[model samples]
Target: MSPLPEVPAAAGVYPITVRWSDMDAYRHVNNVQYLRLFEEARVYAFKDWFGADRDLIDEGLLVVSQAIDYLVPMEFAYAPARVAIWCSGTGAASFDLGYAVAGPEGDDTVYARGRVTLVAYDLLEQRPRRLGEAEREVLGTVRGEPPALRGDRSAAGSRGHR
Candidate 1:
């Protein structure tokens, strides 16, 4: 297996616990539920980086693409996981957000890692738009890190910001 990528200590971390319904029939957390954890993390990151009042949906920004890599299965009642979000990179019309889902354990053992690229879009125009200044400023603060730039860009594309 390829070595897991290194994650920075300063990467924003949002604490989340497994919900009872998150487990599958086999008793392990379902693969799909992990994405929900990442979603919660992203919301927190948006509020922290941007303003809490950021309502991307109303602004017509929504997630268009996402990719996740599952490492090891998590138990139903495992300790709270820390989902970390790092600003991967920014294009003229889009930007990428990388995620590391680490157990309550140390950082090296990320249960999963992934990236989602968001685009700024004008719903009325039905086309991608440039990211706003405020949003860019929030992303700029988390740009200078290894995992952020080191991830895949072929996966990057424009979609809505939310």
Candidate 2:
């Protein structure tokens, strides 16, 4: 496969306010909570594009893989950050989704970035399955480049596997 393009950040504004609970003893947003922000943006994007009925989660799909790169630690003062998401690599059985977190004003001074690969599954078959027509249609519609993989050059290398 060729190198993936630099996927432009999909503009998504999830009006989230920093809560006390999000802060850790160090007073920065917990590392794990940043993942939640990414999820929230993705869920909203899917619903906004495909409607709530055919929800991705309800389709019995789960995030099979994820990678996050923390750029700047979010403090309590950085409330109401916007989360952006985009897509790339709609492979036969799976696709790569990317995310970016930034403060308001839609800046690209990324506070965090992530990529998640998810595969469609047939519960009865008890294994991963190819992307369905409807699913492919939805994923293919995502335009622009995908966020870059952090750390090692390739996604697999970044995952620390040979």
Candidate 3:
């Protein structure tokens, strides 16, 4: 397999445990479980980025889209895998989070790369909401380029909207 690209410096590094249940019949981590891993990382990351005092989830941050590229099969292991996450893009009401699932720090084997688009929403109104200035400022601290997944197009030329 090709060597994975270097993770962005601004990314938050989170160690996520790989449960045996995450393995599939093929003896590798199930493709679907990658999403779960990403979710686990996000839980840890958001708390760090936005602070534990804020309840962003309760306030309504919704996942609008997600994409993952599996580069190498990840076998089950006792040690937790490291998931690096960072804000890749921001808009008026939504933001993109890029993820890289790899071996823990000092280990370069990246198993997958993924991105998720999340929109601020109003739970009471049941509609999308614009991101507040504080939210934007928090996201900016971790902003960085998206992961270089295979067949990725340049963001400026191809990415259409939030």
Candidate 4:
């Protein structure tokens, strides 16, 4: 096998003890469950970076899109899986979060990779909102490390703010 890529530092990491219910008839994690795994890690990253700003949810970002790549099938395990996540980039009114779900040991056995694009919104006005200086600064404070996994489809790997 090709040597695995480096484990880039993440903005946040979540330990995922795959639930019994996460498995399908084949005993592998259901494909859809991967989204949840990504969500868990991303949310943790948001909380870690934003802290009090977490309340911005009311008039802040919403997931405009989410996409994932499955590399290896995963099974429920007592040893928690490691879901490493970070803010890969950002735009005028949106930010992209990157994720890697891997075996507890590390990213060498990556099970899946994903990106979630969140668009800022005005909850009261019912429309999109431009990012403020504060918001931009917060996003910049997250992960500055370059993406470790090659993003085969999206530009989250290196298209916007690093």
- Candidate 2 regions with alpha-carbon error over 4 angstroms: 1-11, 105-108, 154-162
Instruction: Compare candidates 1 and 2 on TM-score and give the better one.
Output: 2
lDDT of 4 by residue, 1-162 (tens): 122234345456678678899999999999999988887766666666778556556556689877787888987777778887777788888887777788776446888877788999988787888988987888776644434445542556457433
Least well predicted 10-residue stretch by lDDT in candidate 4: 1-10
Q: Write the per-residue lDDT of candidate 1 for residues 13-131, one digit (tens) a residue.
A: 77778888898898877989987997888777777777767766456665777777777777754567777887887877788788887766454467787777778788999888888
TM-score of each prediction: 0.76, 0.79, 0.90, 0.80
Once fitted onto the true fold, the runs of candidate 4 whose alpha carbons sit more than 4 angstroms away are 1-7, 106-108, 144-162
Worst 10-residue lDDT window for candidate 3 reads: 1-10
Q: How are the candidates ranked when ordered by lDDT, highest leading?
A: 3, 4, 1, 2
Better of 3 and 4 by lDDT: 3
> Which one wins by lDDT: 1 or 2?
1
Quality of model 4 by C-alpha lDDT: 0.73
- Which candidate number has the best TM-score? 3
Query: Where does model 3 exceed 4 Å of error?
Result: 1-5, 154-162
- Evaluate all candidate structures by whole-model CA lDDT and list the values in order: 0.72, 0.70, 0.87, 0.73
Candidate 2 per-residue lDDT over residues 1-100, each given as its tens digit:
0111233634344655666788899988899988788777777888976677888766656688888889888777554777767676687888777777
Question: What lDDT, from 0 to 1, does candidate 3 have?
Answer: 0.87
